[model samples]
Target: MELSNSTLSSVAGLQVVVCVVFTLIFLVGMLGNSLVIWIILCNIKQQFSTVMLILNLAVADFTVLITLPFWIYSFADGWVFGAPFCNVLLYVVHCSMYASVFFITAMSIERFVAVLYPFAIQKWWRRGTIGKLTIGIWVSAFLFAVPVIDQKATHVEHPQCSLLLSSYRQQKGLIVLETLVGFVIPFLVLSICYALVAKRILKMTLQSKSKSMKVIRSVVIAFAVCWLLYHIINLLTVSSILTKTSSPEVSKMLLNISERVENLAGALAVTNSCINPILYAFAARRFQNGFNTSGIAKLFQQLNISIAEKFSNESNIRRDNFQTSV
Candidate 1:
């Protein structure tokens, strides 16, 4: 469809809005993740598995946030950076996305194990297990993202970076793979984990678990809110493709609609990167009083779940009674 000059002008304005939103996400995500990572590394004393998981998660989020500038430029102008870099960016972004979700799933499962089978963890779970799992997550992400390498390009008019898969089967398969591996499996795992955790915690309340778990739980919810739309759009695209079997015009229309709505979905997917740090800040509750050091920094020192065990016997309800002030 050819855009008239007026339409082009309107699109240009909309592109500016997209760029602005992306830039804000980039800045906030980078700053928040950076601050958390720095404090975790330099300031926080006790480095437990939970902390390591968080550090890895922040790094994963940060990796994707760093790639947003290229995307912002791509949206505002075009893919002037050439196809090679575009392909690399696609791989990194995709890999990081997979890594982030996998890390969340890992954290959830770890928390489950810690809650249910404490003895197994005490006996068999080594300190380096999470490190190895971190490595495996990156490797698995790379393997999952391998298909997209060199597949992205400036195919359409105005040179936007897009996935231009050559085969219909490949496109359908990519959607299926993403839906299953990225969304469905993780959703099931997390739902089951949290269901059991909630069952156990019903008597315990949020106070029974450390705020670290609260932060992780909030991150899981944010991830769902952000990426759920993207996956739904992916399913709709698959539906469109399947609909072509009977009604070509209807399929074309559905495809067009999906395409139009897809930009916003993609933006939300990246928005999850920034949401984590904001959740971390809230979980830190750093603004409650004057602090000599970073409130976020102080939250890390007492992030362990075991620290909450002492509260199991207490009947009085006060979640913030022991809150630290830097």
Candidate 2:
């Protein structure tokens, strides 16, 4: 009886912790993303491909975060919301998640190209290519998220909003699919693009030793850190489904541990939505400082300037230096 009481108490404690963490995330994400949108729209009078991507990302992050209140209540109490509503909520979340990932990847690739082939990016901008790309991104995000509508929260004694796939095979498939599309593919793209950007910055002597590299590393590392645990735990679940254990007790034990950690892992993943605003601020601090010093007008002028033009001039300088050295 004492052990039973203690077990219940521990479970209650964990539930409280989950609720608290999620609540904070919801508050912070909404505010931060709102500020990002406002700055892009009102403060920064000039729009560019990079700014457009940032604006879309902020919108995506904010849209998904709006669902957090419902989720938090689901966690704190239970999933009182009907099954139909659950599906709708999941669809929106999935759509926003896909959009957020794509935009971040798009931004990274854009930056990479700006450093290597600045003129091409400029020509595309003149031709309004970025606007078309943005439309395509949203369409793709919505289409990719359709499958998630079938997700129904697990119905139990408490009716908690736990996303349990319909079948064991389905579970594995969804986990693999989401991990690949959502994190792995994007992670690889971000890593490669940023690494190249860092290298170019070094070659051009753009920023002093290691500064650009550090920011590049942080961007990749932050992306990895946010989603890596969730994927690992999910992959483990897939492995467990495939591998049979001799001891039922051991299997049950492993299952229990994964169950507890998986929720926390999921929370960590949601955190990525909120954390991007912070990373963006840090990454653009130099530009932001200029805007700050010169006020709103300065920001407007600076943001209006084509990033590709600056890189083009820098590349020309490097070309000149190389020729002179020869």
Top candidate, metric lDDT:
1
* Worst-scoring 10-residue span by lDDT in model 1: 310-319
- What total of clashing residue pairs does each candidate reach? 0, 0
TM-score of 2: 0.84
Model 2 Cα lDDT, one tens digit per residue, 204-318: 6434223333443554576678778888887777667765356656556656767768877879878987886666555566544632323433332443464745556767888
- Alpha-carbon lDDT of model 2: 0.74
Off by over 4 Å in 1: 1-3, 124-127, 150-157, 205-210, 290-293, 305-326
Candidate 1 lDDT over residue span 1-326, tens digit each? 45688898888888988889899999989998898789898997767666777898899999999999888887877878877777788789889989899998998887777666554444434556767887898899989988878444224334476777776787899889988998899999999999997776655544526565677798899989999999989988998888898999989988898888877998899999888878877866743554323777666666654533433333232334545321
**lDDT of every predicted structure (CA atoms):** 0.78, 0.74
Residue 11's lDDT within candidate 1 is: 85
What alpha-carbon RMSD in Å does predicted model 1 have with respect to the real structure? 6.4
Q: What TM-score, over all chains together, does every model reach?
A: 0.87, 0.84
